[model samples]
Target: MKPTRFIDSVNCAIEGILHATRTQKHMRYHFLAALAVLFTTLLLRVSSMEFMLLALAVSFVLFAELMNTAVEIVVDMISPGYHPLAKLAKDVAAGAVLVAAFGTAIMGYLVLARYVLPWQKAGLEMIGTESETGMVVSVVLVLIVVVIMKARGGTGTPLEGGGVSGHSAVGFCIATSVALHTQDPLIAVFCFILAAMVSHSRLLLRIHRPREVVAGGLVGVAITVAVHLLFRAFG
Candidate 1:
């Protein structure tokens, strides 16, 4: 339908985002990565100029990805079969996204390296006390991993039923992070119990099989623990 008003235009824009997010795994990954980067930036408290640069880098990559998806769709519809020109068009569009992503990665490293490397000065004993960074990284990694799993398995959409349950993964991920940061047995046990309950709920609803839920919980815990250890070692 043609957009007839400002609100209609906004809704149409949102629909495009939703379409890309649902159909394109890379787009979903970019969205999650963008969130993680922005959250880290807030915690790092970078300079205004640095913040603007990071924001622009993120926007550039996302824009490139969206354009790539659009180009591929158009090419497929126009060609609908083997066509060297269509293939070239899609490849060129994909190459643009790849270049944008690479430049964004370099920009991010230049902006964040100074702030992150300073963690070496902090004592190891004191490092575990800060779980914010570890938790954020763990959750983001789990989400990305889940997205990949869903895309590969072709079992479900991004949010609901999948080969691995993202909700379960994130639930257990945060629980493990909390347990590690607190270093209190009581809190650890409580957190695991909550995580288990969350995983079990998926089973109860029959949204996920026992193995899928278990796999998600295990993935969550494994990723979170690895992240915690890395932060402690470097931070």
Candidate 2:
């Protein structure tokens, strides 16, 4: 019996993912970072929205890295020797990952700052307190997660192709955080509008597909909400 088209397609995708993961050291770093983020999110009891944003950011970086890898692979296969166009293609692909990484870093800072800034304002005693301690710890852990995730997901890495949009994720995360922190509805609304603009820019640039942008936004909102709820429940 022969496999159906769907089955074949699924198998091929799985094979590609496996091959990329196995051969790419960068992919392993990303995987570890993802795990760290997930673990810290749970540990800190971050709001659902916060967790979602983190997850989306992670996914986006990995996706970009994977796509970068794919592009490099294709370029190498087509032009095994040095070629200007091939170099350009690889550079462009790597540039995409770099852009995503920069966005992810910004998102990480926004998310972590939510905790660190408040704690700092309260002084040393606040840092010593259990709640503040937990928040600080969470921030540190989240940073670790971002660092690991961003370490390598770019062209030339083994596992690279199709990632979530870090720009979208960061924009949404910032919007959600602003909304949650500010009780003023008008302010929240304004922040959201700004975030939407940021997300729209990604689409306008043709750097990300609609679904990828939407997914990134959803993840940011979900994670933020989750983190808030969890902290409320446990704290």
Candidate 3:
């Protein structure tokens, strides 16, 4: 489809991503790995320069993979028959992805090595965490996303599994909010433990599967962490 409007162009780009993610397991893996790495940067409080370098490396790998996927699709479409040239094209594209991935891995290791804490690190103690405004925004945003997820799934009510857990989501959201606001590792640990119990009850009662409860908890925690990170990153 030809994109005539700005929104259409954006939609087309997102569609490409969706198609790639659905069809390519490697793309999905890279996305999950990138998410984990980005979250680690947040937790480690890496310098902005280091974060930018890591982000660039991630982008380079993703870009190479996307191009490789595009090349493979085009090659398959054009050469439905078995041909050495087609195989070579695919192999070369795959090779590009491998090289890009390897380089990015090295870059990530170098950037993160110094930031990683030693094995004998001191006890966990976080101080002067995010502001009140960030905490409030995070909780509100988590609630909004939870509702959206529940509505989109439409399989079960908020409290039930099959859908986002109204109880577990809010429980985790509040727990995350309090944890960030308190700036105490022990407090954060305790709050998250409580949140886990709330989700566990859902599992024991059979109102939702373990997957559903875990999904809800992840949603809440992810949203809260993202909001706090945004606040800390910009303000």
Better of 2 and 3 by TM-score: 3
Q: What digit string (tens of lDDT, one per residue) describes model 1 on residues 103-210?
A: 999899889978874463343334455468778999999999999998898887888888998878999998887866765544665687898998999989888998
TM-score of 1: 0.52
* Whole-model lDDT, model 2: 0.67
lDDT of 1: 0.87
What would the TM-scores of all predictions be? 0.52, 0.48, 0.51
* Residue 182 of model 3, lDDT score: 65
lDDT of 2 at 72: 86
Candidate 3 C-alpha lDDT tens digits along 5-31: 999999988998888889999999999
lDDT of 3 at 111: 80
Q: CA lDDT of each candidate?
A: 0.87, 0.67, 0.81
Cα lDDT of model 2 by residue, 98-162, tens digit: 88877876776667656544543454232222233333343444333333443443421122112
| Stretches > 4 Å off in candidate 2 | 1-3, 116-235
Clash count, one per candidate: 0, 34, 1
Score candidate 2 by TM-score against the native: 0.48
- Order of the predicted models by lDDT, top scorer first: 1, 3, 2
